[model samples]
Target: MEGHTGCTTKIVTLCTFKLSDAHVHYRTPLTSYFISHTSHLTSHWQSITLQNLYLIPHTSYPIPHTPYPIPHTSYFILHTSYFINNIYYL
Candidate 1:
């Protein structure tokens, strides 16, 4: 994975293989910025979200309800779950 920063923005990049099977997961403790991507031999999976103090964007994936205290800024946690065949992996 690669992370980049601009004047007031951040970017992240990741690479994967086509034949590979993978699942990605993410969670945040506070409002923050996060983006994720998965690469296949033919295409890539991309997602981006910005968490604000007042509101957060809707995501296709469901987020768990946790009772962690949130600060004024943004926080992000990213996790990827990978599985192959009948085997479980991360």
Candidate 2:
């Protein structure tokens, strides 16, 4: 987490299958989350999960400083991504 302290963009990839598998398995696409340099990734995602759970569609609720509203379809994706990211970090 050394170089990550600055304002830099990072790409976090979440895979559906293990890397040991060579077979061409279908990958589940995930929605990308752009976290700010000022925030911790895991903690921010956890907060996002909460906001998404309670947010209604078409509401003006933004994910913290982000302008995007929580979409109905993103509920499952956010939870899955958060869990995956948490596991990866651990």
Candidate 3:
């Protein structure tokens, strides 16, 4: 379990247990365990996305000893715009 305190902060709860040796002999309730695991995974993924941000951009690495050591104008422009957008949103 963990929590944070900001606009993106979130509280998360996790539960895990192992069946005892004697309890494992009874397999009737195994189906319910699978269902609970699936639901917990789905909720965890949703909560993670809600607490984080992502960015995407086209990128190129320049070769050394070349006349141009940086990305081309088009790629540079795309990366610059991405940075500006994130800054504005934040």
Q: Estimate each model's TM-score.
A: 0.18, 0.16, 0.14
TM-score between candidate 1 and the true structure: 0.18
Question: Which number leads on lDDT?
Answer: 1
- Rank by lDDT, highest first: 1, 2, 3
lDDT digits (tens) for residues 7-83 of candidate 2: 12222222222212222112333643332221223233321222111112223323444344444322221222333
Model 2 pairs whose backbones collide: none
lDDT of 1 by residue, 1-90 (tens): 222222122212322222123232344545332322322212443342212111123342344542343421222223223322221111
TM-score, candidate 2, is 0.16
RMSD of each: 14.8, 14.8, 20.7
Q: Residues 1-90, candidate 3, lDDT per residue (tens digit)?
A: 233323321122312222121111112222311111222232433332222222112233322223322223211111211121121111
Q: What are the lDDT figures for the candidates, one per model?
A: 0.27, 0.25, 0.22
Which residue window of length 10 is worst by lDDT in model 3?
Answer: 74-83
Better of 1 and 2 by TM-score: 1
* Best-to-worst ranking by TM-score: 1, 2, 3
